[model samples]
Target chain A: MPIIVNLDVMMARRKMSLTELSERVGITMANLSILKTGKAKAVRLETLEAICRVLNCQPGDILEFVEE
Target chain B: MNIKSKLAGIIINVSSFVIITGYGYTLYPSGIHNWMYSYKETDSLNLPVSQYEALNDSILTMRNLKNGYGFDHDNGQFAYLGTQTSIACDTCSYTWFKNNTQTYNQNYIKLNAWGIKKELPYKFYVKNKQGYVRKAVPVKNSDSKFNIVDVPVKFRYNTMDDAILIPVSADGASLFDTGWLILWGLNMIGLLFLLYLFIRFSYDTSKGRLFTRKNVTRLKLIAVSVTVYPLSIILLNLLVRFVFRQYFSPEVVLKDMVWYNAYIVLLIGIVLSLLYGAYNRAQLLQEEQDLTV
Candidate 1:
């Protein structure tokens, strides 16, 4: 519940739409929306790797942890 | 995961279906027939009247005295005025006796008694030692004595045994019988429904929907049904006992194996409910994973 996803920030920095990122990373747009909204409970290493490969960003750039 | 689960699910589904169908085919008929005919006694061994008199005396001697419809009998001394309504020593305290007469409105009792008098007359039978009705007594009770009704003789000496006394017509169709059939029929329906739920759950698992909300709900339903199934049976037993206490003695339903089996079912339901909770947690995790992208 504490971890947050920063996918939308990275997508904005890359000048890419969620649809475009989903196409590049081989994930669904709905799933990308979930990541962008910070509602994802967890992220698998492989999926993070794929996302990083597509957007040219580190996993830390797309993920953040906030203490409650 | 999907293929292996599918194979396991298909095997389980087919096995369950076959077992249920096999039980329906091979065992249900005779079992149902035996239960249905529990009220009817056959192959009675005839005993002499003197022996019956002695047997009756011994039974009376062994038991204590209690009030019989408001008549008090002295200890060690008693009388048999007629069937169970007679003022005899209390041998029947082994079970609860419902005073059907006083519980009624006097006017209704009178009306019902009158209607019964006009309709099929009570036939008295002399019971043989083997517990068969040897002869029907021709003399009927005078109309003035409406309370003196003939009690049906019990086939066995043990008065505490449970008997399902369904008041059927000559053709054996009555309200009580119909209701009993319907109640047990619902048990069968519940079993079939449970089977369907099981198959559906297995199918969902095979389709990789094990942690889905739909599968969780299905498991909950199956759990509730399993719990309720035994409870329904216990209730039906109680209902039968309460209704037929006058004509026959019903065993203590809680003393039977059904009660023990019910506890097992309750355990199963609790376990299944927990399983559903676990699946719910898994579903949340799955959602998180799907969204992780």
Candidate 2:
């Protein structure tokens, strides 16, 4: 339950909007929303690679473990 | 939360509906009078005289046709007509002939109001000034518990006198009734779509993660397919029944063959969906374990 998606934090640090990041990463706004809101049950490595490539970040930057 | 669990839930819900609806259709057919009668021998032979008289007339006709009719006291041959057969439901009734000498005083008659088959098992002896006259009972067995063991008389429904009984055999018609055929087709299409998703999910998950945009789209499509497919089947059944009533007579439309097919199709769909769900779940679990190692 505490598997957090830190895409929003990365986006904020990069000073980018969700729409801009989605377009750059070649993923849909809906999927980006899924990740940003932590609604996704799990993340595919390929998707993480695309996000990292576009945002100049690593998997660790976008995923974090926290206590519920 | 998992895709497999979600699919399993959908399968279970749809399977339950198919089973319940199948029983409902079997128990209640439109425009048929289904009745069962149980008679206890009384001292006065309290029977419906008019119905018995009608049955006697039919028996006389059958006897005349045979050209070898006799009132042998030894041979148990007789006729009776009556609406006294109390059907457990409001739909039908039965009547039969009984012998006073026989130790088995209890007689039963079953009438298939839709199919005009009557069975009367007991022979009744009527005492008249001339002597004893034997009578046979006219009743039909319409997939009910009772059977009229003698002549087959046509059943009448809603003032229609010429109503003929069409013997309904469970295996006479096509296995997939029209409604079931349609459901089966829909479920097949859904299964194909699910298979596509399953393949996509497998391919994506094999690459070590399911976060890809294509994988997400596939998952969404799978969820939507599972939710909509069964709901559409139920709605389509209602639509077909409505159309059937609007365009055809209820007597012709309410045959068991029509709905039996639908039930079978639904059952098959449920089974396939459950298998698909379980298979996908196992695959996902395996992928997760691989990732953990």
Candidate 3:
């Protein structure tokens, strides 16, 4: 419940549309939308690596912790 | 490729394959026979208490008629009036008369050889003023002279529509036939497996839960398969109809085609609804990730 996903901030900083980010990250637009909407239950290391490569960001920059 | 998602895929594929293969094998011998047989037990009531009583009474009356006329040991034939019509019983032969003529013959016999009286139940049909009637009469007292008084009987009007001429016994042995048991068992297992896979698919999270790219793609694949599989059946049926146009009427062909198509469409809608829930979950996950970033 406390897991964090920083997809929105990363998208804004990189100035990338969801479609563009999905293409760059090699994921589907539907999946990119999922990440943007905080619907993911967990994220894989490989997927995180892909996002970092596309947006030029660290994992910590994209993730945060919050108490539920 | 999380464990749960992988398991769900395996379950779906295995269940579909098993159902298709089982039905194909069972029906290949006689497709219509298998289909109609599946409906038979459900469509008609099984051997009810009333039917059993009717059978018992008929057998008892036949035996009484055999005894009353001092014909119990004679081995000669005797005929009497059944509740609905006239029934005749003999030591070796039995017939039922209706409309002033013998309308039924007992070529076959059902004997409870282990019973105290060692009696056999005989089945025959008679045509009366109303119509053809089917009755079961049991006969007893084989060692004594044949008498008309010992035959016990009850008549049952055959009300079954689309009667397949399948023999039914009051003993309930044929109800437990191996083929029927296997069919029902497989259907129950397949349904339970489907439910298990659905629950697992919903709760799985290793591939980032239902909303993740991999999981959603997997779900989409399954949904598409569910949709296309039934559609393929309809398409094949249509093609066959077209190829055999001279042999079949347009109305007959169209009716069957539309019925199956509608069924397929309903199945597709159900699958899509499940996928939509998974997609919505993915959206919520993405929004959470976006807010944190």
Most DockQ-accurate candidate: 1
Supply the DockQ value of model 2.
0.04
Candidate 1 has which clashing residue pairs, if any?
B45-B130, B47-B129, B162-B250
Which of the CAPRI classes, incorrect, acceptable, medium or high, describes model 1? acceptable
- Show the lowest summed lDDT stretch of 10 residues, model 2 chain B: B72-81
Q: Which stretches of candidate 3 lie over 4 Å from their true place?
A: B1-293
| Candidate 1 residue spans exceeding 4 A from truth | A1-14, A19-30, A37-39, A43-68, B1-173, B245-255
lDDT of 2 by residue, B44-160 (tens): 333366534443443432222121112111111111101111111111111122212222111111111222212222222111111111122333554444432222222212112
Per-candidate TM equals 0.45, 0.29, 0.26
**Candidate number that wins on DockQ, 1 or 3:** 1
lDDT of each: 0.47, 0.42, 0.43
Q: Give one digit per residue, the lDDT tens place, for model 3 in B1-293.
A: 69965654454343333432344335323321121121122213344565444433433343332322111211111011011112234331112311234322211111111011112122222212111212223346555543221221222211111111111232332332333356456646754765565666666764455455545555655566556645654564455445434433211213333455658675885768586676868766775675332
| Index of the highest-lDDT prediction | 1
